[model samples]
Target: MGDTEPRLDRGEALAATGVGCFLWVPATGQLILDPVGRDALDLLPGEYRGLAEDLRPKILRDDWTLLSGLSAALRGGLKDAYSAYFRVALHDGRSRWTHVRGNVVRDGSDGVTRVVGVVRDATLDLSPSSLRPPADEDSDHLHTLGEAAIALARAMSVREVGAVLGDELCLRRLGVKAMSLAVLEQGRLRLVRSVLSLDDAEPPQKSRLADSWPLNDVVRSARPLFFTSVPDFLDRYPRLAPHQHGFHATAAAFLPLVEQGQPLGAMGMFYENTNSFSLADHTLMTAWSRAVARALHRVTMLDRSREIAAGLQNAMLPRRIPETPGGRITVRYRTARQGVRVGGDWYDAVTLPDGGVGVAIGDVQGHDTEAAALMGQLRVAMTAYAAEGHPCEWVLAKASAFLAELGADRFATCQYLRIALATGAVHAANAGHPLPLLRRTDGTVDRLELAGGPPLGLPADWDLTPYSPTSARLDPGETLLLYSDGLVERPGEDIDRGLARLSAAFSAGPADLEELADHLLDTLTPGPHAEDDAALLMLRRDAA
Candidate 1:
């Protein structure tokens, strides 16, 4: 080789050849070789060598493709530039593993040139018997287990981690006939995940296991336990004898799924053919279980926090309607039946400056903390407006404008009603809500007619029509009812049906304000677990 060209020295050539077979090429599709390794290059057949030669030009043109091909050729054993490998089978029917590791070279001026690396043959079996006793195999298994643990820890859910562990470690590789993860719920073991062999003719399935099994024992003791054979396990614990016939063989292992000293569950691995679980396997599985347990605990805590928050939001709503003179008022509220969907449903009854009571009800657009907070803000704003003696239409318009200005657009629906005690007149304005029902002392019931407007949070330029409040003379024994939509609506029931039910309940009895309020709530919507928050308010005119 010329002095201008880079070349591998004697030791360098041997080190490269010893680790793996390597080939390097310049940007111009030329092979650059050191003197010592020229003889070894002749060993490859012309066809194979031609293929190698063809790679030089492509590699020079596309560095990423070149590096990826090199890495793939080396079976992922090679790392870093200046090193690469290719496994080749000789004409004599022998195969060899090779490793290549090296670095890339860049011209300081251009910052783009060619790769430079070493190739070496790294073919070693390193099986348990061939390697040093005890420590080597133990370390290898431990390393594998650590990788599995890291994988499990990155998983998003407990079920995901369980699937990965059950499939990758226990089922395919370990020759286990079956594997399962059982969670300890209220002191009893509940099967959460299971993997069974499809080839079995008469596979026995175990239901929820008792608390006295060896798996629970391991969890209670916070340790790992192994049984070399099924008979031995059964002999030690007779409770397992009845379940032994279903398993292919008696060998089993139990690892405690624990997190921060608290036992959450247990994982069990079973082998049909008898074999003892090595200490390394036990240790690795224990670590895997601990990771899974931590994930489970996190999910459980989040679910509980949501439940408590929902309860708190529900408690913030008024439990009873305020008493108003001249007319009767009753209200009901329901939350969504789905888990943790607590949201912003609010109703308020305030004594207006003119002695006419203002009744307002609204629902925010979301089922979360933001919705609840916005609801509280709107409720307070409405109360302020009512105290200022704003008419129902003006109160709604101002409130809607305020919400829009505050950037609460597209978030809420509200209905406000002003009832004058002296005149027996009910003035109402609606901003996208179900109309209230008015039941006369006679057999007839009517839907109070009111003009509808856009819900709060729309742009200020949006139309704000003054709603014409409807008026009706309150009969001596008649009742006026205001309610949130949840009262009569259910998943499969018709809206008209729900309204009819409400009307019938009101007319069924000539009840007083308190009795009517309770009757409407208890008959129409009752339960601590209402799917949506319901608010009901009723006012009755006393008989002369």
Candidate 2:
């Protein structure tokens, strides 16, 4: 539309109709309204000359949703023109019906970026015999609520929940200027997340619940608090007068998050120019706080549960890797990242009486407590058998038989290493386990091709063959790597591919055994969210 087109027709056809003109720029969120439009919205002449978001507190949540999505519909090519009927909160605490109609402005590239609209008082148009808003006008708010719920539900920790709530895109969609969340912990408030700030001084992360702050007051009284302007805030809390100069917000809302009559925490929202908050604003904010409280509680419990599971799993692994005087030993055990259940992967290293080191890495059949229990027992048996100076093959056989005798109806894959540090000799035994890799001093890598027996705990009739030891020599400055399948397993891909990747990583890894250990785990493991647990052991024969 031309600049003079709407003005000319508007002046001629609607001069006496009590209508007003507005031009909205989607890019900057600027909404310019003439004198009549200001009156129709019940706003003073100088009250709102900034962004459209500054009027959110005066509009109901559902109505705000309609107003915000109006330009979006035109930009998406869904419509060339739009019309909406919504209620605006009047200064006297009454809702007045308002009507707005707009047409999108497209540039030379046919891209819509601006909207030209006219607004008028629509209270009389909402009569029983008059036009009504579309039935789907309220659906937008419900959709917004549903999306937030889904994101909160998927959060695995309190930090993650905070991230979801503080997301910039989410805040933009809701027209929120700044947001802060704090939870009550043992009579104190602990800040969880803070997004966007209009204050020069940051709020303390932890504060006593009895502190003289709006958020603290809401938590104590279990009610919402609203400040219509900066002066309102200063008047209500005179003790904070000295800090008023640092606060740039024009309006603020602090809502208590209570569930089942129990107070959880509080949420604070700050706005630039919102003068008043309507009842609809109160209702919507209360509902949102309830959702946040629930999500926070759930994730807190999950994080604690995971910590407990991890503690138990750690208790079952070796407390220390006995010193290898003639070599270096580095080991790492990582639990599964997806769930609270403990996994069965474990590693053990013990200094032999004859100055050698007994190292073993294994994984049991399942990922539950039962599997973990069986792993502890099997690990002890293998350590005892190897410490007794038994051969590598004998240790595997005894451990396998011990697992079967437990009658747990489970199996385990294990690789045992008896290293003579002085001679750099490694005798490895395999029981249906991935072969150990030897990183030669020359930077080449090779697998110890040992014959594998059936996994431990199989019936005698089902056992294919006895475990066999593979003898390999590790030269000075060379390292031996033993790890569970999780270190080299990717979903829906061949094991060979993962193994190949591991080989390339190990060969090009750092020279220091300790750094090499970290390099292999960082390069080979999928991520912190790996589905399976992994235990890794690296032993390097130091040069004489």
Candidate 3:
């Protein structure tokens, strides 16, 4: 098609008919929707590229099924151009009767490659039965109700929402016999905890979609399925009748829950008697379903974020001990089993061009992926600030300002240490973190306590967490220990006790850097617990 000569006559013909041109590239699964076509269809401006299956929802479901598939149209018979008449269901509640004529572009062997088409609005020619007008009244009522539901759902915490969903006043308005929200988890609809009319009612015992073909089709089609009578539902699925043995329901409705066209789950409504759902009941449930879908989407995103955060942290953290011109640097990263969830502890080392090295360890405040994501941002800023050859105090100051400017609500405690290899001098800056421990050649250990500034992500523009750049000489056989509070602190124990334990562990450990790093934590605590993630960065100003 790309090599074919321009058809001036074809272009003029389309223009005369006031039609829009389109191209479907199967290789990329892209539908090039023209601006004119989009206007007629009432699509968003951002919905302009790489759209293939995205078109399915725009066309009426029945109409889409009637259209011949691309493969079938080009199967061994160079099929001539054909016309398709369908009703477009716009997302903004508009409808369009569309006429499309397309021809498959085939290779020399007649294998279909691309499809080119022209579309025209045929609303004037189509009768009411063929083309429905805009659903303004229903959409308006539904949208208004959906907004109210969202507002109510958002105001309540997840627990509160769960508690109120079935017995709550808002839900009672529907007068449903029973309601269950089942989210698709691990390819199954697991019933979320909620209040139900039947005190000990157990939802469909089957967890996976394979156990219920009716529910699977409902989710797959992203449509509502209602059974006004038992005979109708039972006759449709005799195999599933036995599975519904204990249920006492005369009517049922399953409204598929979808977000961004992806099926998330479904909400099931059961009634005690055979009944028709009034238009008002249907609209109200639609609103509730939307609200429920949003809540589920939020939770799903948080879980996804945790996985992403852990992966991102792992990727960015130092993989191998950095090569230094002087001292030995060993790092141990322990993730919290509970307190910080999966994304809390991180350590990094970046070498400077002047035979110097900068190291920092910090704990971001969070138990989930949000905290981990913030940790990444702050760590990257620290790395860049350090690598930029800034001094300890300057790096900390700039990093703090960067975090504050970035609008991170949570704060992090960081301890930055810069070692000058030529002089064996260590400069330190603290940001509300545990003080570093210093050990001399004579087996004496003492805290290099510094009055560090506030944690990062605070309104500390006036140098509130001012970096003073504490100076210390790193003589051969001496050590400096830096760690997150998790290494020392316990739930009920005092801060002083934790510090005392850390000092005792370092003093009792061997002179070897690696062994000492491992021994330090082992001596202080039995093993990593669920409270918090611990980080240890040890440096031996190696024997010169």
Q: TM-score for each prediction?
A: 0.44, 0.69, 0.43
Best lDDT among the predictions, by candidate number:
2
Q: How would you encode candidate 2's per-residue C-alpha lDDT over 1-544 as one tens digit per residue? A: 6667434565756647879888875433468887777888888756786567556677754344344336334323356687776668899867777888988765524222567989998767644222111223345545666776776676667666666665433444344555778888888987776533324244567889888777788999987888887777878887666654444677778889877677878888776556876655565567677788888888777778889889989999988888888898899877776668788998898878788998999999998999899999999888998889888888888898899899999999988888899997888788888988888888899988877777888877674688877887878888888889888775555677567667877887778877778767765553235667888999888877
Regions of candidate 3 where Cα sits further than 4 Å from its true position: 1-312, 460-465
Give candidate 1's root-mean-square deviation (CA, Å).
23.6
**lDDT of every predicted structure (CA atoms):** 0.59, 0.74, 0.67
Query: Candidate 2: lDDT over CA atoms?
Result: 0.74
lDDT of 1 at 88: 37
How much is 435 displaced in model 3, in angstroms? 0.5
lDDT of 3 by residue, 1-544 (tens): 4798766787667666668878875433468867666665556767555566567667765344224433334321346466666668877665667777788764423222467887778766553232221223665455555544653444222322343344322332344555666667778766654223223343453476765555566776788898988899888777655555355777788888888877887777776644676676676668777777777676566556545545666765667768876678898866553322655567888898677888898887776677777777888889998998888888888887887887867788898988886678888888888888888887779888765677877776454636787887788778878888878766654577557656655775677888888766544444213356678887777677
Q: For residues 1-544, what per-residue lDDT tens digits would candidate 1 score against the true structure? A: 6678777687765755453233442222234444333323224333334223433322222112213333322211233243333333444544343344555443324322234555433345311223222323766655655665555554434444455554322233333445677666666665555443323321222333344666667767787778886567767777545544444555677778777777777787765544756656566556655666777676555456656766766666655556666655655555553346667888888878788788888888877777777787787887789779887878888888777766755458888887777677777888888887777767467777678777877776656555455555666766667676777765544576567667766665444667667667655553223455566666666655
User: In model 1, what lDDT does residue 410 have?
Assistant: 47
The number of clashing residue pairs in each candidate reads 50, 0, 2
